[model samples]
Target: MIKSTDIIRCCASPHGIFWLTVAVLAIPNVALCFTERMGIMASVTNIVLPVAAVWLLMALGRRPGKTALLLFPLMFLAAFQIVLLYLFGHSIIAVDMFLNLVTTNVGEAMELLDNLLPAIVIVVVIYVPVIVLAVVSLRRGDVLSRSFLLRQRRRSLAALVAGAACMAGSYLAGRDYSARLHLYPLNVFYNIYLAADRYKATADYPQTSAGFSFNAVPTHAASGREVYVLVIGETARACSFGLYGYGRNTTPMLQRTGGLTVFSDAITQSNTTHKSVPMLLSAASAEDYGRIYREKGIITAFREAGFHTTFISNQRPNHSFIDIFGKEADDWKFIKEETERSDMYDEDMLRMVNDILDKKRAKELIVLHTYGSHFNYRERYRRSEAVFRPDNASEAKVSNRRQLLNAYDNSIRSTDRFLSLLIRQLDRSGAVSAMLYTSDHGENIFDDGRRLFLHASPIPSYYELHVPLLIWMSPSYRQMYAAEAAAVGSNSRKSVATSASVFHTMLSLAGISTPLRADSLSVASSSYKPGERHYLNDHNLPVAIKKILRGDEDFVMFRKMNLKY
Candidate 1:
């Protein structure tokens, strides 16, 4: 048996330290093999390429330890990747994830971090020691002998050749195994580049869209009093809503209300609010996101049609496209900005709506951006709305799923009451009114074995894509626009609908005609027709929904709902 001192000496040797560094760097690649389900050849190339890269660095550097410090960035990325994998299960780093890093508020970040402690612990345990070892090696000034360096360099070259051969074989087999797409560090870096490009485009949005116009005209005469409200909800998944056939009575208030048409097959084109909310507000769909850069949102369309438009939001602005679009309204305010707190309920937005209704403009379009059922759900509603018990769990672990869901469902109940009250307020105002409600996107709550929670995963689940879309026409409005009301009711369950329909449908409901409006996409029009559903991929490209459903669970879900993916 070897002595402890001998083992320690061996570990401290230049060759041993180099191997340690390689192993530490390979941890993420090994994790990727499981998370991404890489093929044998692809996995081999993934493992070998990094080994060769680190070996080459070791061979080229005059002092190995000093050179290893360059790898700190890679180590940090690895830590981040590991945490994301733990949260979302699979997929590479996405541009939206990077945007969220900057867009998410301090309170929201702290709430998320509270649930992410387990992953954080693992990352610290794995990476902290490596950092300490790197410093120690640098202080020791360890150097490999010239002969040893030459031998290692040759081995590294051979390793690179083997990795290249594996890549070649994978390509010949018709696998899309490109280094820029499949490899870890390269793919993550490419996502960073994409994020940077999107940031630049966002900065240039005002100038790019300055000259765009809807040239909208109202078909209905401006004599009558008309009120239209679009309530944009946050993180409210369809599967949890009682109106959508959930076992819980999460939406009793809305269920009891009359003239509500529920679209059973509604889905959002994108999961992230920053992307999805803009799509809902603008005429852009995933198929034509480029239009978003060139055109203003529906608020502008309504304004041009000679309506007094107002936007009231429960969320704080992060200087995103959402803010730009909201400001296009004649008047807009972020409720969170006024309160300086994140715990305010969705009902806070209704006060602004009530104020606007009291103003009694002849023709008005009010958009209420609600903080409906967002995470840390207990804080979203009052204690009386906590009909679902034991909803106090703050941690996001799967074991506490029942409590988390209780809180989430309770928040939904609160949203139901808020909507019911708004509808009542609108009805009492005696305007020829219609209200359209849809979530920015849905959420995940450990619904299945995948253990996903929250929205905006690089890869979406069935829960994240499916959302509730409802239309409620007041009695007087239904009487005035009988055919449009009937058309909306008839088309409620006719086909798969997307949040893209919101702009055209709202315009149709208000009898606003614009060259930009597509009647085929408007559910309130007799010309409406169903079309294939698509999702916005991480790259912001339109992908056929069927192509992105990762497993049979998502496929079965769509099929059960009779939705064409």
Candidate 2:
């Protein structure tokens, strides 16, 4: 028979109590994960929550047992599910936020549940054990009685402090490295979480001076011109396009067209479209956006200038930051292809654009925002019929990754085909149609070894910033604005531009004037300089771009960031 003390030691071990504490403490950390971006399940979330729970209970003198250990798996599973909710919660919340806005929860849970399986599996695998232990601990309450545990564990106080430090330190490090650029110190964890957004928005503030802010362009010209079309692309970083020196034939038609002004060195001020689009049209840098006056965004400027401005986007109107641009557009239409609801190609948007062009009967500015090259690549593209498979499987037996990429490229090709038609239509209309095409950002395009596609920080390399910007002025408009054409084509040093200059450039093209317009950005203005480009990351930090512009020998060899605007 086993000795009585040996049996007692087994019953009094701390593992059981520790696991139970974790299950309880996990509730809050899982909740915070949802506030970031949609669709993520970081492994870091797995360890921290439970450890904190154990730390809290052990700090008060609790000894664990077989029952508590048994509870571990079950709680672990539940915690996993909660992390899934945290990651894709925004997408799921689409139904919830929408339902609550309209008061309908009929399909809320089910819809979120469908996309949640991957995250769910990951969570259940991690948490199931802890959950089982929590239940077992509650049932065998007598053996693990609270008062007896407190008295027995009184001498373990030093170990408790050490364990708590480990737990707290892990959470702090994970929060900083995993989310905030690995930038903040440990003590600043709470402060970092609290002030993340304020920092991103603060970028626009530094650009503002005294009485000025972002550019304020009137929608209509004093001359009362016709229509202007702004085609805003998605995830189309310039680093990949052949026109910008990539080996691919991404923009042949754009290159063939003589009137298109390709900005070889244009940089986006923000990493994600959510931040970039607002900064672009809002007429401010990420640093100086809202110093004093809340200047209107692109469409807002057009509206204020007396034009009926509208926005047609393939991106979900409610997808996180789409609202940043969507809210300012006088008319907003979000076309999500995944719904299988709309019967339109990119060109079909032309019908709507044409309708507005006719209905307005005066000058107009139209913005067509695309959902091009977004991941879930297969869904974005047409069925691939191309013979060249990257992985050498020309047949249909290819992996999901290969097929997904092929599908994505096909989608880009389809967009190109649509653009060709759009340009032809604009040319045939007999009215001046000035078209400017630029993506909010670019895609990864399988450049990095990372399996999944991502646009924001951590993986934000040059591929995300170098985007194709093709501006084409209709023949009549070109004739009228020949000096602008010469300025754009000139090899002079002053033509350089950051995405911030796009607002001023468009305003100048449309004969609209804005206070923030620099001479280089305005064809109407004679003042110009060369060799200046400012690029910003998701955080709106200038360090990366500044290095490239300072004639860093590495960038100089590649002729990278020094492009004329």
Candidate 3:
């Protein structure tokens, strides 16, 4: 029973056109939920945010030109979602994804675009018409009359109230659900802000001598020629390793290698390399990550303990957190110039290792950061080295699931070769030496039907955090420190462990006594206890590691020892 005059006025006005554009763009937003196959309640709840956004835009876009421009942000966000959905088969804009697009170099960005060309085409097809429609609507001379403005001002206030009420209701229902609401531009904005703030915090963080002292060193400093090698791997998951009970023999070399102890329960503190590497290299934990980097990192401690510290990386040297620690080392070498390189394999770092070891420093600690099993898994190894054949040939599409798994397993096998060669080098050195190996973070390969394909989701998954930790020492080193070897062997099967323990354990491995060191956190000590491990996302949201691993939301346990976070 609508009047013809009223319908004509609505069609001719800029306010009406802007709302129409918003409504069209909103389909992609709500479509995200349906595509993910979320429950009816969750899908219905998600509409509340977009509806509020529509009204808020209507309030702000009173002017014709302003309305068109404002609509661009939402439309662009929707376009971005379309591209991601086509590429990853999902639309969860995460902190790592934001930084990779905005902060990474042009080449890396190009590589990413090149990999997802098919998805890009789909995005263009879906969004180009909408963009045209918006521009045409904006170019119109239509305006809001005095009467219309008065009415909209009132609607604007109501929309604001409704938005707030919707957010509150979502939060009251569940904190986790509230965080998961993927409202297009708002969610995108939150992730970008978090990435920028996090990077700034790391760069501008202050370091003081307040809690740092050199006099805390204990009397167990190495007497003879000793070498401590730490190999920091990239994107390796414990479940993929044969030693950790995987069906595939991904880590055949490690399984057959002697004098290697595998800690089955190890997990990383963060899922991204930027955050995880800092936590592993520095005495940082989930509770005090902001201020922990202010203290001197492990490299500084080793240098102070009269050991020649060296850092060699196969990955590019663009990471601020890693670069800061590397700068502190006596010798820092970067073998790879590009951030993402397909021609250079992880074995490239071995040349640097051999060169450094040739120097024969009496007491030294060398850290090798390798490009191990990063995405585009097929490119990580050479064409000749692709042992697992018929893997995914196109990055844009997973035409075959078994092929993708084969490619991933092949990359893992390449890592096994790299580690085995590294151990052989240490063995040949014949110096009292020990090597510690672990990945910065793990990768996600759509294990569940949920279609989660990568790390950095706000949601926590067990495979993304559970990483492999291996400790290998030469015969001479084991004989020299039998007690330490025994302790490591005894604690390999402990139910809980985290990268936070790396700082304390590295200090113990170097036999350097320091007040900052805690024996309870060290795996090579009788008093060692695998205490409660807490996992955190880029937004600083906490998830109980134990609860998630057990697939139980409500499980409680007590800690036998107190360890500072």
RMSD of 1: 2.0
Clashes of each: 0, 54, 1
TM-score of 1: 0.95
Error of 2 at 204 (Å): 17
Model 3 per-residue lDDT tens digits across residues 1-565: 9998887467445765656565667767676776654444445556655666565566564565456556676667677777666544555677766665544556555666777777677767655655554566557655667677667657766765765666566566654554434455566788878879777766664444346654435345446688899888888888788887788878888888999998877878787777777677877776567645467678888888888999887766665677777777998877666445548888988877898789888888999888787777777787787777797563645455566677888989999999999999999987888988899887767564444455655444566777889999899878988988898899887744456788878888778888778888888777897777877655665556654442221121112111122
- Evaluated at residue 30, the lDDT of candidate 1 is 83
110-175: candidate 2 lDDT, tens digit per residue: 443443455666665545544454455555552445765565355345444554455455456544
Runs off by more than 4 Å, candidate 3: 1-17, 28-46, 56-66, 80-92, 95-97, 100-103, 117-119, 136-192, 206-218, 338-342, 396-398, 547-565
- Tell how far residue 350 is off in model 3, in angstroms: 0.9
The per-residue C-alpha lDDT of model 3 at residue 378 equals: 79
| Candidate scoring better on lDDT of 1 and 2 | 1
Task: Report RMSD for candidate 3.
Answer: 5.5
lDDT winner among the candidates? 1
Q: What are the models' TM-scores?
A: 0.95, 0.67, 0.84
What's the lDDT for residue 174 in model 3? Answer: 59
Please provide, for model 1 over 202-313, each residue's C-alpha lDDT reduced to its tens digit, 9 standing for 90 to 100. 8899899988889999999667799999999999988899998899999999999998999998889999988999999999999898888889999999999999999998
